[model samples]
Target chain A: MVLEATNNVLRLDANFVDYTLVAIYFVFVIGIGLLARRQVSTSLDFFLSGRSLPAWVTGLAFISANLGAVEIMGMSANGAQIGMATMHYYWIGAIPAMLFLGVVMMPFYYGSKVRSVPEFMRRRFGTGAHLVNALSFALAQLLIAGVNLYLLATIVNVLLGWPLWVSLIAAAAVVVTYTALGGLSAAIYNEVLQFFVIVAALLPLTLVGLHRVGGIDGLVDKVNNGPVENMLSSWPGQNLTGFESPAASVIGIVLGLGFVLSFGYWTTNFVEVQRAMASNSMSAARRAPIIGSFPKMFIPFIIIIPGIIASVLAPEILALNEGKGDGNIQYNDALLILIRDLLPNGMLGVAIAGLMAAFMAGMAANISAFNTVFSYDLWQQYVKKDRPDGYYTRVGRIATIAATIIAIFTALLASGYSNLMDYLQTLFGFFNAPLFATFILGMFWKRMTATAGWAGLASGTIAAIGVAVLSQDALGPLSVGAIDLKGQGASFVAAGAAFFVDIVVSVIVTMFTQPRVESELKGLVYSLTPKEDRTDPNEKNLPWYQRPVLLAGISLVMVIILNIVFH
Target chain B: MADTDKQAAKEKRAIRAFDIRTIIGALLGIYGVILVLMGIFASDSDLKGGDGSSTNLFTGIVLLVVSAFFLTWVRLRPLLVPEGDDDAADAHIE
Candidate 1:
């Protein structure tokens, strides 16, 4: 903790009033939380904001869901470690995934009025499938929450010189408390405030970092001449044959992550899914992600550019220690280093505050969504049965506290990892890929049975765990090199295999399992269509235009473009 | 008989237009699936280099073109509502 590091660590002209400006900025966020408390009442109101938010709110909330310290820290670290290829995560990965989800997948959730994604799956598939998806989601979020808190701590430790644990505890406590008190409404409102502050504070820092580094051209020249820059330019493969080729490295980034990872994230993750569920209408839900996607276009420039610049600024420290040493790259430390050694005093505090906002936005979103799923899908749907509005609100608060505790424990455990970004991404793959496969299969394919969903989930989990364990042993012959197997990719492969297996098995089993009763089938399909249309005798003769088909088309076009471009 | 004949004519016209959006949407969705698949495999290749920057630029251009077409096409097509389709409950397109 370097809080007491020289006060004039990085001298730049600033007014004495900057401190006041920073304080006022925090107060504004707190004010949003307070004002939002009026919106939470019933369990639905608490969890989903009574399913009536405007597109902008949902849009801001969607971006805030991603505006975690892990993403910010990881993006910068990636830039420092991998060069410009890091931008592919957003350009080729996230944006298209988001648009696809908004247009193609959201209608089912909003149309059938599902409180949680797992519940929607259960309704369409079966309870066993629902449980697997639910548990996996909880596990994934636990890892995500942990990594997010760790990054927040690092930022605080780097800038404010505060103890990692102290910062972690403070961030966790504030986010948990506010989320518990106001539910999704408070989180969304607070997120809007954080979004503005982060952009205002960090955007300027990125510009200055580039300017000081003598712009992109200067940075590029510096990198070309530096020994450390060579490592950053090319990815090293453990196999050491053709595996280490720079072209292969780029392709891996474009395909492995840009498309597969992006689709899995936006389409299935609870936080992103919940944003659409919060919108007032299907149209609004669709609009939310489109609007949210716009911010992502600028994010790589704001976050990653600084890291690339940092590499040039501190090539000596950024050096990779191979063989005899820990091989520490300290890519994650670049942002804090920049703030402490680059930005002036008052602005340092403002930037730290912006980092704080990023952490809180992520924490608040997770807590709010976790509480919603637990209280609505798990609690009211099962435990309480019939409680008053006030009672549900109180219970929702308790659930929020419980979720916060789980997240804190997760964060504490996750803090031990040296590379926060790698851990976060890898850990997400462990569960996310499987969950996504099941959800996509369950949603689109009517023939997918519950048996298949459960089997896929169990098998995927086992496969991921197996690979993770074996990869650790010397005899296992694991050769990913810098990449960890127990991390996201192994899980993703296992999950994907299970999903494909389930589709085949479920189809086979369904033949023996008896088709869903005509009554059940009718309820499922007809509920998704307008009642009057269903009742019409000449429905086939009516216009064949379908909204899902239209949306799905746009999603298809975008995905194709991303693949082609990134490929 | 005249009224029935008139109604049938309108339905025929609506169905023709309806085919446009559904066909286009379906085509776009197929493309999206392909792209996702390609992203998975392509990520392990050379699509991410300074020299590879051309690949990204080209892909982006294709996407912009396709998206522009789909967006414009969808707007041009009207919702193909069935006659007496008043049950708002079925509006869900998922």
Candidate 2:
């Protein structure tokens, strides 16, 4: 295979047809956004799609919104480096948390009628807790949006030889225009479209790559013969060092990713939950995440397998340099290299369209969540109260534009980071770890006081920052030990530590403080809410296979089988 | 009797045939069909890029089938207007 090298920079041989196909994708996405404009008459419609979307639409969009450029590029990079252990992000990290959101938390969110996740915090805890959580969430969304934009621009610049600035500006303009006009309905609809585009784009690449490398067995043999060994194993030991970090033991993966980070993101992060909240009914809302879990189980085959194939096909490009300068193969370019080397012109255009769609869907998801939190949680609540529905709707539109502009600058700043996924998860550790602790204490325990809630949130966040600082070797005086805990392992350790600290602080404070009255606690806490209110009214009417429990059970069984086979 | 009339009007307004699913299904089917055609008629040069294979053609078929399934699902169980405004109340919470 001949790889095009121009000035030592590898570029995909994209022609006029490829560029035309990509342009068509942009027009189609923006058109969908404008088409949905008719549906956005009220603030509720703008932010939550009038709460009328079905389970399938919401479910697909739920997973699609999370499948950003970072996920496609970053996970494949991990797959190349660590092999099958990358599946943990899907199976252990994502599936359980998604199920918990559907089965346990959706009732409180949908039943109580909170517009956003921070509002849930306010209703459960008090203003101080709400503001802290809301501000952190809003900031995190912007940063994450910036990261997505940065990754997309970098990949485009490398593949198409377009200037990074042009890519960033064009992407921002398309996403902001559609998002501002269409609202959440437009975002969700486009996400479903983007989901199909991504799958269509990547599945072909995987098939072609596998065929070139030989079939599944050929892939296995090629990968084993390459520099990396045990590329097919899911377990930590046995030559598979779990996500390229020695510190990422089985326990660390379980607690950090599976419990704290995953639960924090899937359950409380407004970006994902906003999709479920837009469902037509409480039953649909509960089922949305559950339905999403079905596709979430099999996504690794398309995404991760390409990276593994690249490890064997282009080891020179996949190689890393210890120095801070240029490496033999930039790890993040795994997906791009596969496309450049493998796909034909017509098919290449389709893959590029899929890549762009994934980037736009991710940016739109973050921007949508940012606008909702800013308008409802921050602006309407504090900046101006009791505004007309149209007023908040206007604010949401303005917020989308503002957030996009801010994200552009943030993306520019994010160019300094070497690994996109590591930067993202570390940020998640800073906010999500402590945030999940607060949510857990408030949800299951009725006696948990507002004072305790704020304390746990504040202290838990502080603990995470402290652990991160101490884990750094450069900060010698601040370093706790010589152990250099990095990657997901460091984030997991910080989150696990914060989880316990938040629990301890919350428990002690709740014991000393007065609990809210029964009336105040109704529908908010598990113990106080009636059993009938908690149960889905349509559960008994549906067939056995259609129920959330059975769906979750089947998904878990499949995950278990994959783990066993891969292990 | 006036309340009943008002309720009837609201229900009538809510009973529209078009929904998000219809839009998703139709758009995906259109795009998938176009892609499949392009893949099948790809030039010799294009075929060289993919090693004389039809990966795009197969993937496009899969997308087309999935899109049809979504459309069929909507036809089987169409959305109806709920009797009361539970969502409206939830949406307005301070």
Candidate 3:
């Protein structure tokens, strides 16, 4: 990371009370781990919360698991760089896909009782697709986990002024002990706690920042009259998309981010799918992502608005980002600058705790998911089969420790990025976009053979990486400048390329190969599975408001309204 | 069969004793109390060129209200462990 030597790096500027609040928060996190330890006995409990969490709990955990580096630092960075156009990430990019996961995808995931998303792939397309998915998914989790761990320790380094390694080790120890002790239950419990704590921490920063910028009207007036054009509007997003033409910008965001990237991420990423899988019943499982969608659509207000406020209040932020000023505060520091300027000590402590909670929760989610796939999909399926249930649980704990150790090194790789989201999006485009393509194609089209499944996954991943490498400034210095797309334009184009390649390859491969018999495709494929099989019988008696379809419909409408209003 | 049921019941009893909502409620209550106290006692001289709005006090009250809701919900619908293998527990909404 480039040290902004002229300016302090996210200094809490704390006193006695601020440290006290953060310490108390840590104690509560450890306490929750101890409470959850009693619930774990079998590997199932350790990995999947024994599939016994309530919808409300799982729903909150679904969103909270996501509220890590991306939601805070990444979105705020987008908010600073692109202004109102950043809302695309939430309203169009996330909400619809999340609802799709709830109403369309969760039945296949939960009803079949697969332990992980890759396990479902195994059942559908045999071991070839399963192996490809498991290896890629495991690798993706570790790299992403490293990102979360690095950011968490970065906050600790700034707040306490500790050496980077010392902060890294301390942060890792807290997450690993809790995750190892109680496993998924512990992580889920802490995630719910972290959710509330993070909200408490951020809500005040937003309101206070808004107050400083005068109000909503004042913010609009200032932005409308500010230095840049197209910052106030979310549509076309010319500034964000790096397109001179409005048409190209709109198409890029909708097809690249909205259709391909969003669907790929929300539907197939096991880190998210695992949260819904932990729900006790089919109905609760389906409802998890939908319940999450309610808060998911509205989070940009709390997260991005603060960044907009920071950019206005601190003119040096933009000046430094554009290399016009001698000072060195990047756009990634937008939220930190707000915290420093707007908040007093009591709330400052809360804000610091919130940033830690966000990073920790994100790392814990990744570590927990990594351990599960490592133990079940990689270890048990491949290395040591027929092990006793208790033996696998032990392996999971060991895997948690091993993942933490590996993540310490991986964290170093992430330090190179000025804006963390750029790195994160490139990773997601490589891993998730192709995986989503293979998953959706196989799930809907029964003729998609096992050979096609693995082939599409491999080829699509290569294509995404290939496109990203060609784009300007996407892979940092590794980019070749063959492509003119800038910033997240490379990510969007890469995701689109991955999706297209996966589909075309799968179709061509399927024509030359044999598919499984219709009888074998029952719950895994769309057309072959009966409608009744998708829903739990108990869901019949659920209230209208609580029904999955009704909830998803409501969520879809609300997100559409938000998009139009913001547009 | 009887022995298995007895074991399941005992395990369920242990689980019920450590209700997750209770932990969340208690922690939120602690943070809320601390913040409320600080909001009352902390001098306002620190805020830059102050408007008198108490961000700490308001945030504390909201946390307390949310904490109360969680505690109340848990009291109304406590966890029930069904008489079956752990794989097939009855799904109940909290």
* lDDT of residue A522 for candidate 1: 30
lDDT of 1 by residue, A1-567 (tens): 112223323232333333444455455555555555654534565777656666766877798788887688777776765565566667667877777777656666665667778777667666777766666666666566766766666555545556767877877777776777668877876676567557645665676667677886887787777544343332322111123456654554444455555676778777877876777656667667776776765677778778777776754335642222233335666566565455543344456667787887887777776766666566666678666555767877987787777877776666554344354445456556556566666555555556666666666555544444454321133424334433333433344443455455555665666444444433234333454422324423534332333443554565466445533
lDDT of 2 by residue, A1-567 (tens): 011223236577887767877777787788788777866666887999878887888999999999997788878888877788889888888999999888889999888788899999999998989998888889888988887887777667767887888988988899999999989988998898888778777888898889888898898887777666666777773233224554458778778778987888889889999999998877888889999998988898999999888887764444541123244466667788788788877568778888888988899999999999999999988889976567999999999999999999988777654344344546555777878888877989998999999999888877877777667421233546545665456667778888888889999999999987877877789989887776678778988766777777787788788778877
In candidate 2, which residue pairs clash?
A317-A329
- Winning candidate number (TM-score): 3
Q: Which stretches of candidate 3 lie over 4 Å from their true place?
A: A1-9, A321-323, A413-428, B1-14, B51-53, B82-94
Instruction: Locate the minimum summed-lDDT window of 10 residues in model 1 chain A.
Output: A234-243
Going through the candidates in the order shown, the clash numbers are 20, 1, 0
Residue A203 lDDT, candidate 3, scale 0-100: 83
- lDDT over C-alpha atoms for residue B86 of model 3: 44
As a whole number from 0 to 100, the lDDT of residue A523 in candidate 1 is 27
Candidate that beats the other on TM-score, 2 or 3, i.e. the better one: 3
True contacts kept of 2: 0.33
lDDT of 3 by residue, A14-129 (tens): 88888888898899888878877887756777899878888888999998998997578878877877788999988878888999899988998887778899998998898998
Tell me each candidate's RMSD, in Å, in order: 13.5, 3.9, 3.1
Q: Could you report the DockQ of all the candidates, in the order they appear?
A: 0.02, 0.35, 0.36
